[model samples]
Target chain A: MALPVHASPLERIWHYAYLVICALIFVFLVAPILVVIPLSFNAEPYFTFTDKMLSLDPAGYSLRWYDSLLTFGMLAPDAPRDGAWYADMWRNAAWVKAAKNSIIVGFWATLLATVLGTLAALGLSRPDMPWRRAIMAILISPMIVPIIIIATGMFFFYSNPCSILGFECGRLTSTYTGIVLAHTILGIPFVIITVTATLVGFDQSLNRAAASLGASPRRTFFRITLPLILPGVISGALFAFVTSFDEVVAVLFLAGADQQTIPRQMWNGIREQISPAILAVATILVVISIGLLTTVELLRRRSERLRGMTPR
Target chain B: MADLTAAAPLTTADGRPLKEALARAQRRAKTRAFLLVAPLLLFVIVSFVIPIAQMLHRSVYHDGFSANAPAVSAWFAANPPGTPPDEAAFAALAEDFRAMKAAKTAGEAGTRVNYTLPESRSLFTKTARDADRLAPPYRDAFLAVDPKWADPEVWQAMRSSSSAYTSDFYLSATDFRHTADGGIERVEPRQRIYVYLYIKTFVLSGVITLLCLILAFPVAHLLATLPMAKANLLMILVLLPFWTSLLVRTTSWMVLLQGQGVVNETLLSLGLITDSGRLRLINNQTGTIIVMTHVLLPFMILPLYSVMRVIPPSYVRAARSLGASSWTAFRRVYLPLTLPGIGAGALLVFILAVGYYITPALVGGADGQLFSNMIQFHMSKSNWSLAAALSAMLLAGVLLLYWLYDRLIGIDNLKLG
Candidate 1:
């Protein structure tokens, strides 16, 4: 907005100061992430920049910490760089195993959340859907409720799946099933929200028209509705994937010794030691989030176009 | 119409009554839609809802000692409070302790009582060890084994804990317990922790919310006023933090704020403080506040930005043209319009911050611990009842706020980056 002609000089000074304030906050937001990248490359073990590091000396940087991530939990880290070393890392490096666990948990959790959430969103979008507001609230409660409460609840629920039911189903805690189930619960709300937002602009008349043309409901869904909502579903799936990938609380409560995920590993590392390896991991996560962000952004635009939300 | 339908039997082209055919179609549609959602709904109920409900149930559910020491439990069931420990009560306890000792279940029995009376685990095990040596007039035998058995408070605690249901854990969660005479009483000063943690959680989260609101308002205003391309570019700064792994951001804070880390080192080089005087920032309240503010700031900025982006600038300009000073114009016109965003952002931040676990766990040392940390502590110790009680209170507060948020800004409007 332009300054009024009658504005006081005091107001003008305040305006410039306000701009400075905003700029500083922007730095506050981004500088932490920026600060970690260079430190991860530091040849020194210190978190701060070394004298040579500030002087831009070549010897001040190294990839040794990244090497440590490979050998952090390896059965034999000092071995030569060969098949045995790689195999030891594959089987035993804590971070490597964590990464694998993160993938498996994220994949299954996302698949469950996306499939269930998408179907529910489809139902929720229908005009004739029963108890719409109440059902929506129930589905979305996992997102709103405090995560610690949820984790505590899962801790109990998984302790004895047979506690309430007559039949015995064995314990769910400290198992892949428990962590995956917990992540799936946490991821459902995101999928429901994203998919439902896309579904808001859907035309119901198309379904009726297909029915009038003698198309079965399943065929009509696959041929028309699924195609139209594919972008939304994909984005929703990605959202679910990210939610599961970034999750740590449930994993903390439910995952067993071998089920440690990356976040859990990072939690241990950050707590026990602030190694440059953690920074290396943080750098990779930052990069992964950037990719996820870009993909979600693109899919959002496509979904908007499919729903005719934006003019051509 | 009724007479006509009766006479003509109103039918569709398919030769069925119109109402019946339409009703059948509607029922089929409803069932089909319901069938699609049924699997997930059932899954959520089984996995999420029931767990939460059961956890709350566990808060008031105390069957540990009752289930373990059935004879003593039956004595309490047979005789109410104020009933002196005659032969039957003492004999029942003696028999139960003997069985527990023989079965090696005295530890569980002790743990159950220890929850009510701290440092009393050894008492159970000790009494169980001496149970066989006791003669008749068993009260003296019990008293000779341990003076704690002579205290009516122990009996009161036992009587209350004997039942399957008791409010002792909830009372303990709120920093209260049963007295000798069966009246609820304040716990000792040394024993009071949960209340302090709750207070600290609320106060710090309140401060964080207020800080976020003050900091985020101007940035959101600038973004809303700027050109689309510039605003979107600037928005990335906010969105990037939102998308980043929470641990990464927390790690960055740890790196910057730890002793001898970036901030302290820089200050040290600048002679701001000596090596010994480098700020104790990490693993304390300061670290928790700084990092949480950094992490949750995006949540505050997003809602404020979304709401601010819609308000026409003309209103403020029009107020300015009416001879209102800039401060007066903003206060009277601009601030009021953004109140919805302010409320939403504050509540959202507060709700999330209050339940915070990972950041506080990583950075918050002793003085900065929250209620959730206490829950985690008890959970790991297998103190399920106490953890459940704490969780019940937390879940209640969060649910209330959630309902408010849903009512004020429909859940459908909940947006993620």
Candidate 2:
């Protein structure tokens, strides 16, 4: 709200103080995250800036921490820089392997979540869908429930998925399949939320018109509905991917040593050794999140525009 | 025409009855819609709901004792509680001890009973190891191995655990233990943890929720009142942290708040405090609160901003014009109007904060741990029953709030960016 000209001096002073307070809060919100980026490059194995860094000396900055990300688990970390060294890093570096596992699990989990969640969102958004509220709650309850509870439950159930059925089977724990299944459950709510948000602005009449024009339901979805909602679906998919990518508790409970994702590795790194390498990883992850956030924002604006709604 | 149609159901042009056709079509549409959602629904139920239900079952049931000591369990079943150590009971214990020794499950049985009767696990294993030396006077024989066998409380524990299921874990979770007389009593003062942690979890969560609101309100108001473009740009300040990885945020906090970290360093150079007076910020209660508030602040701001943005600034103007001071106008008009947002944000943050594990686990040292950390501890220790019980309690509290949330805010209105 704009300050009125008739406002008293105390009111004007309070307004200025309020703005300053808001600015400080904003700094509190953002400064900690922004603080890590520069510190990640500190020449020393320290969490703070050195005098050289304060003075803007080139010697104060180093890529050693980022370099350690590649060389930490490499079998021949000290080998000369060559093709074999790069291959060793790709194959054996702890962070690289963890990143690979994260991508694999995130990709499969997002795929499954997007497909199943989109279908459910479409159904839930329909007027004739039965038991809509109850079903919607069940679908998204994973998000509301604490990750520890969900992880604990999955830890027990996945260990013996058939235990409740009075039978024995192979355990799902410590397996990629189990991790993917858990991540999918965690990601499904985001997909449902984003996709259904888009569906809210959908014009069902277009689908009806396509049907009246003798287009089959599948044909109509592929041709008319899919094109209009692709942005939403993609947005939902990205959300699901991010959810899977960022998940750690489930990985901690369900993953084996071989299934270490980036978060899992970072968790171990943080707990066992608070190295600058972790800060380096955190910086890279921060950049990735910024990119993802920007992408989602763009997609959201495009979705609004495609639906013929004015962008906020 | 009406009379004719009443006698013969209304027919389409092709002479088919329209009523049956329409009913069948409607049924098909309903089925189709259900089929679309069926896969995900089933997936969630199997992967999510059933596992939680199974965990709840574990909370009340552990078969470690019942499955191993079949003869003793059966004897306890035939006899009622408060039954003294009769000859038959001692003989059954001897028999089960022999079986346990053979099956190498004395440790298992004792572990189960130890959950209720502390230190009895060693007695079970110790007696089971020397079962071969037992004589016909079984009561004396068992007592000779360990005088604790004469304690009725041990018998009560075994009796309660006689079946494959028992509520002992739940009882213990609420800080009560079974007495020798077959009644529940609070555990020793020194041993009580779960209830204290629960209260602390809620109180701390309440405090954190309040802190988040205080920090968030001004920013949310600023953002909501600002022009759209500037608000969106400033919103990045909020969204970046929201989008950043949780572990990263936690790590950054650790860096900033650690004793030798930036904050302390700055404070030290400024003479804010002497070297020895450096704040014990990380790995304590204050660290837990600060990190959690920062993490959950976005949750509060988004909802408050959304609500304030649509409040039709005229409401406050109306109040101001009616001889109300700016402060009075805000208090009377703006504050009350934002109540819904306050309630939603507070409940959401509290619910989330109550269940927070990773943040408190990482930043919270010994005294800073929450209820969820206790759950994680039990899980890691392979104490599945206790973990499940603690989880069930946490889940109950969460579900109640969730129900409150659904009733108040409507789950459909739950939004994320």
Candidate 3:
């Protein structure tokens, strides 16, 4: 790809122009996301950069938005800075409650998706698996199908859980179980994808060798296969967690006021009114995603190295 | 081969034929593999597949008119098409009106009929309120109560809606209406939205996919041609956005594109235009296209880069060495090699954009809205049947593209990094 010295002036100009075009495209890709990181620190109650802020005046920046994230829904905002004040903030802040709900729902959904998806991936990766293509398509369809469709269908189906069985039962809507199940379905494709990919590089003979050495099937799985595939499983679990954390449409349809997750809360905020507090929340989520992305990337590298696909 | 065919089939140690034994072993393996996947398969069927099926079923099935207007339904069943209403038909209608009045289900029956005949729900309720006064001359008495009921179109609508399951919703969804003579015709232009919106959704998605491909091509090419360390450094810029929360990215666009937002401010300060000429970017089609192209650019870039990275630079060089011009080598040698990536990325982006809801909801006000937003609008209005029908249409379109993607580029090759 290096430019040749024997090339003509026209070719040299084209090469430089191509690089400049690429640089602008990269800026287009990254700038909007990075813009919010600084705007979240704006002292004035605006989404744009004030002149002072742009000029790098120290007085133009503040932690007011981050502070508002704590006090917006609390019982008292002017209370003294004490343990009770902190307790009150944690107890009643709307954002705090949303973060809690997001974590709880994400954890259970990730656990369920990872376990079920890992098992299914193992079955699918087996050479003698029956109807693999069709089954894989079915499993991955929750991802391919539009979220709005899934949300609407879940709305009706969850409204009456037992009606499909020709009986009466309680509703799953507005409950933790319903949200978890919906998110799990949404998260399964990622799990299946990542784990199955990891298994592609797996050496199946290890399990056979363990079995041949008088180890039971269960022992072989726990002692050899699980250990080898743990990185993929963890990465899949992280992906599932993030998917649930970021999901909004399903939550909007299924969650009641008491079960509001972060995205749901942010949706209400943006629709009702845009506040700097939302930007604060967005900033924190960006940080979290950065952390999760790093983890997954490192694990990917570790898995590749472990499988001897990369040199040390 | 003839000798082998003549010989007896080879046997295993236990005297079973080898072919039978081998087949049995393979069958057992397949069953075991299937067993491992059965729990998830059943879970998905119950939680995902069944719910979607039920939603689709709701599009064609509503028991409101059939269950509540039993007498009229029975009379219609006894009679055939083109049957003029007689004394018995009027008597049956009066009986059903009385029954519906007793049950307080006039509204439900009216709502079901309202799908095909607008404002007919009020007709049912209005008639049922005066059902107690109707005399034996039921046909004349009904005409006196509501002169509109004398219309043949009313009778046609009622007859069509008498069944528990009908295709009226699908007809209405596609902007066609049932005629007075029992034939289908297009609704008036003023009322036709779904078909137009469907077309708009597909066309807008196509434009966005094309924009994404244009924006992503050079960047992907650069990444593919760069040295490894440099490419990885630039890759972070792409992956960071891919991993960011969708809401976060969408909110950034909102902040950037709003009228008083940064983009306008920057343009205003730069004297690009008068302050009055600030672009109406947000809450319009331009905003939707711009934001979506940004959001989906990564999808195009990743696939293109993955495809391009494996392409040998030697081919293009050899073309140049053999006296082919740079443009000629690129057009003939490189472009064809990248076609698969283009197809995959375009289909993926187009499918996602077609069903996109959140971005359009926030920024795509009235004229910019897609088909999914219309479905949501119906759902919020509690018009479940129309919403279900629209969703079914969207789902069908998406699944077709998905199947196409699977055929052209195997689903197993779908990558995320």
Off by over 4 Å in 3: B1-9
lDDT per residue (tens digit) for residues A1-312 in model 3: 689999899999999998899889988988888888899999999999999999999899999999998888899878997999999988899999999999999999999999999999999999999889999999999988989999999999999978999997999999999999999999999999999989999999988899999999889888998888888999999989999999999999999988999999999999999987888889999999889888887888789888888542
- Per-residue alpha-carbon lDDT of candidate 3 for residues B1-417, written as tens digits (9 for 90 to 100): 889866878899999999999999999999989998999999999999999999989999998899999999998899997687789989999999988889999999999999989989889899989988888899989998999878888888999999989999999999999998889999999999899999999999999999999998998888899997788788888988888998999899999988889999999999997889989998999989988898889989988999999899999999999999999999999999999888888888988899999889988877889999999999998888989999999999999999999999988877776
Interface RMSD of 2: 1.0
Residue pairs with colliding backbones in model 3 are none
Best by DockQ: 2
What value does the lDDT take at residue A305 in candidate 2? 92
Lowest summed lDDT across 10 adjacent residues in model 3 chain B is found at B408-417
Residues B64-116, candidate 1: write the lDDT tens digits. 78988999899888887788777789888888887887888888877777888
User: Chain A TM-score of each model, in the order shown?
Assistant: 0.93, 0.97, 0.97
lDDT of 2 by residue, A23-56 (tens): 9999999999999999999999999889999999
Per-candidate local distance difference test: 0.87, 0.92, 0.91
**Of the candidates numbered 1 and 2, which has the greater lDDT value?**
2
Tell me which of candidates 1 and 3 scores higher on TM-score: 3
Error of 1 at A271 (Å): 1.6
Each model's iRMS: 1.7, 1.0, 1.1
